[model samples]
Target: MMEKADICHIVMYPSPGRGHLMSLVELAQSLLRRHPSLAITVLISSPPHLLPSIIPYLSSVSSATPSIAFRHLPPSPSPSLSSAPTAFSDDPAMYFEYARLNNPNLYHDLSELLSDSQPSQKPKALVVDFFYSVAAEVAAALRLPTYYFLPAGANPLAAFLYLPTLHKLTTSSFKDLDGNVDIPGVPPIPAKHMPSRMLDRSSRIYGHFLETSTRLAESAGLISNTFEALEPRALKAISEGLCVPDGRTPPVYCIGPLVAADDHISKHECLIWLDSQPSQSVLFMSFGSMGVFSSKQLREIAHALEKSGVRFLWVVRYPPPHDEMWRNLAIKPEDDPGIDEILPSGFTERTKDRGLVLKSWAPQVAVLSHDSVGGFLSHCGWNSVMEAVFAGVPMIVWPLYAEQKLNRAYLAWDLKLVLAVAESEGGFVTTDELAERVSELMLSEKGREVRGRAAEMRNEARQALSEGGSSRVAMAKLVDSFKKGMM
Candidate 1:
């Protein structure tokens, strides 16, 4: 007799950011590993990238697993959303305004597409992105088994997926200007601490994002790109929020920081350097893919790293400046988009013995797990935050871009799990400040205390991956649902 297949999985997500896209792809890979008999298909909004290397990694899922496949759906044609200049490329204030105007139809078109697709075997299950819960509405209409896949950090999703309700309780639930509010699950997430963009109610698009994500949180099961122990309170809240009519809550699993074996183009060099440094001595820094700093701020960061007098590893992947190009543009920093001259002069040489720098994709998990690495200086991206916590490293949070500033408060102040580095006068901090913060973390007693707690968190995080772990249990139940159609 021919071999039999167990389940058919269809995954849907829109890839506006690397973190979201990467998490969706990893979940597919993980499901493939655990249940090799499953046939998985991932549906994305587009089949392109700004950086060519991103194209490969995005497409890596297909290469890694022959049993898994991909399909692309176009965003319904629109005048502005159709290849427009984002604010960073032109004017930030205006671009976001445009995105806000386009939400209703954008949601409608995606929802319609999910509704129209017909599967031959009744799709063993539907796994959808947290941001596109409208797709879940379609899946529900079709009566297909469904699961929610959050493509960002679990803690953030746990908070955001509940934002509309949270907004109802606090006056600060809004669209403009940063405000702080207490997120009941975690510690107090201050209203002033909210990301500026998320506070605007006038923006239909922002509202849609929160509304859609919140719906996904209430699905039959919620899947996170994180482990349970990292943010137990948030995970529990998410579990309770998705309660079924029968007094049962949907399953929520945290299996993440989906460390890619290779980024599809380059090998990870950070791991090699980590081997050379002493235990907890190297401060690992990466501002996430979208991190941007003015020329002045860039210089200050270089200065700070140099002044710290601590061994470090940093990844710089910015595109070349308008006026300056990398000396070996066509190659050299091979995997990088092109950022050599964008870096400060003599900075690399000044810290040569103590620092190791890479221009492109480097092995992140390997570096975090290395003995030489101690603290992480991060941009507060959920994936990066999860990785640091899972690895048991304390963080020096320096949020530079995107909803990250909101996360900074959660990590540094609310959780008391990571140290928060203050932003400077010009909305950007200087290297002197960075160096000073480095000292506070490495040389001071307060730094030692935070590190001690972070180390303790590390053990707790690992326990979630152990046998009978919460995350493991969730994953098993999810897989079982696909076969039994309990979803």
Candidate 2:
């Protein structure tokens, strides 16, 4: 073991959700593997409802990596709201408020950790998830360098850094805009295709998002979970300072494809089923943790799947209540009802020979990496997208919420790695439309071409993580800058 005095220490603060935490943890693991003398302390601030889901993952990481430590900040009281938000579970305002309320605890915990460290082990930086940009002020008062880790690709980062400019240019909400909105790196985003939070400029969530976007420029550097080969154009635009027109863009480090480690012990039935299928014949469909559908939407999907005749493994979740008040809330895994109760009657029996419909959860990373899996019908969340990319699986982009619509735009229009599924008004996909996209992705010539591209990208992703690759070089540069105190 290395001497304590020779270690370089750092603090990482990720936002509340599982996706955000997983990204930062993977990043820490990567850093520790490269520089064994480095020490990391991850500060976790989980919402009360999400704590259970987070604990098991945290325990596993601690057991596997003793060099990395975890500290749970005492929960801050919930912010007083004027009214109950539409989707309380997935609300951005809740995340922002949690981060804001925990500022004092963050300062105390960080100061204590730093003061306790040996002289040579003073923390080189305090890295935070972009959602917690408000913490930069705390880092500043303590005289620590602050960096923002965006758990997303470069295209979303470009849009986020450019959001303040877009806000200034527009007089109305993005949803009401007459034409496409232009960010520096990516193609013009249709007004309706902008992130749901940005659609209403007057909402509290929009205000919080705009503030976070403005504050991102104050960081020492921005690190994204994407590689140079994956997003060449967007990365170039960011490097050239095109995204931030009025301010200096901080140095950007592209160190990723930071996927979660696959679970090797517990093999799911889905994996067993995939083993029996022909090579590259199964299409896997799963939404991210927050993704849910209405009963009507679920039925439509079942109809499409049964009619398509493709071998498949789908993870099904209970539909949200039709009650307007509860319609947007996420369905927890424990809350999932019987599969037969939600899907079309006899849907499971009809598709039994060709498909396996699992309830609520699956080992997503393992399934995507399986040899028999060819296509992914995904919600286009960045983490899910990266996992698919790493597995070399082409996708059918079906964006649900958060920045997913924007991600869909990038994956489909800019990268051409996935086929886009168009949604009708109020975000419903028809049976015919779903079936057609499924067939196109599984059997058509276009599917073959996209599959080839995804394969090429998978190789590039592996290469980027290897020695002498772009991501590895970027990782070295980040560590060097930290060591030299070059902000």
Candidate 3:
């Protein structure tokens, strides 16, 4: 029994991709846990192929948490893939960007749904992913306050917020700026380590990034997927308006390290293998949903893993076109090619005793939570980083695309939670370098120190989420702000 005056309805729109969707869902769950009578409607802007995989999870969450609900936006009116960001058309992210550019459909459908709703069903505030920034105008038209939900760490948000200032100060592109050019709240990072999209002003994706950042700054508030203890300096800089000129940055609520629960524990064989291994003896490697490698890179990785002598569970997927096929249809083992087809000849046979080469996706959260797992070799996606921190696992950073390079810099150089596998000429990491780094992280005293730090961070993450903790207080403030129309 909570009072009717305490209830508030919040509409959440998550951009496409599993990481973004998962963060938003976890935030919704956390809100319901902390505040009674809070209702959430998650409006999804995912592709047709991706929806089937997510619907079951949404159904389970809805059944368990009565206050949370879901809705899918209708197809785009102009569903042409050619209208997508032209700079990186081959990248899988183009699909989401295409959906985002055509988000007038989401606005139209949401308006219709809200118009026909009862007074109780009306949303008090709208919360949206950074990609779906167009929803800010929709929220304004409906007289609802909007908050931008940044699924990445505060470092990326700070970078985005200050990018305009950096652009104005420099005569050339980001690629031409000094390697040590500093952004407020973040370490002085080289242009190579900054987000690649923001480097070239002529690129379509660059323009989109610029526009989204401006829109996010103009919103009522910001919700970041990071806890206060994890990023105190970055959070403080944003709140104090160090990045934005004129001290006009929005109020920030850091209620995160929001990770998925291990719901599919019984669904994978790797868990059984992990149960038999000694404590803290295994490594887990995964690139987030869109991470793919060429056949040459896969062979190099296989050789490196064999050379390291460390126990590992690696999730491998074929290069895209085939890699993306799972999104469109159910992935059957018989239908998809085996590891033998992709990896070097006899690679699996040689490593079968100490390694598990799982094709495509694995139950990541379940695998990370296993006692036998110690270190993660990852693409440095923010969700994966948070999950690793929560599980007390150190990392070897292997950034591939998007904002991952920045994440790698933050984790390995700034936060000291990870070791980076250095890339050779042409952005390809040498086999020897990969093997050496893996061995160091899985065996050396330096690795032990990093592991200890990770455990300490895990404790801090728990503390931030506990009762009377920083995240709990921030969440309370967020709810109050939305409810009172004070944002």
Instruction: Tell me, by lDDT, which candidate is best.
Output: 2
| RMSD to the hidden true structure, all candidates | 5.5, 3.0, 3.9
- Candidate 3 per-residue lDDT over residues 1-487, each given as its tens digit: 7655566878888876566777788889989887867888888776554566677778888888888878877645544543343222365446446556656776676676567546655677889888777777777777778999887898898999987787778667777666676878887788866887777777777777777788778888899878988887788788888989854898988888887766583657889989888888898999987788866788899999999999999999786544433444455435666678768888889988899888888888899999999889999989889888888899998988778888877788988889998896467887899999999998999999898999999999989889998888889999988776523
Candidate 2 residue-wise lDDT, 313-420, digit = tens: 998877665533234334444464478867788989888888999877899999999999989999999988889999999999999887888888888987888999
The clash numbers for all candidates, in the given order, read 22, 0, 0
Candidate 2 Cα RMSD (Å): 3.0
- Where does candidate 3 have its weakest 10-residue lDDT segment? 80-89
lDDT (tens digit, per residue) of candidate 1 on 1-487? 2254434545455444455667777777776776676666665453233334346665666776886666555543454554553422343333333333434444444454445455423355667655455665555655656677765555666556656666566554453335445554655554545555565655654666666655654566777777665666776665675322223356676666455544324445567667777888988887776765554566677778877788888876664343234343444333454344666767777788999877644667667777888888888887788777777888898876556766776677767888877775446776667788898887789889999998888777667656777666666777777776424
> Model 1 scores what on Cα lDDT?
0.63
Off by over 4 Å in 1: 1-5, 14-18, 47-55, 74-76, 79-120, 169-179, 241-251, 261-275, 317-345, 424-426, 484-487
Top model number, TM-score: 2
Write out the backbone clash pairs for model 2. none
* Cα-based lDDT at residue 140, candidate 3: 79
Compared with the true structure, model 3 gives a TM-score of 0.91
Q: What lDDT would candidate 3 get against the real structure?
A: 0.80
Candidate 3 regions exceeding 4 Å error are: 1-5, 81-104, 109-118, 265-267, 321-335
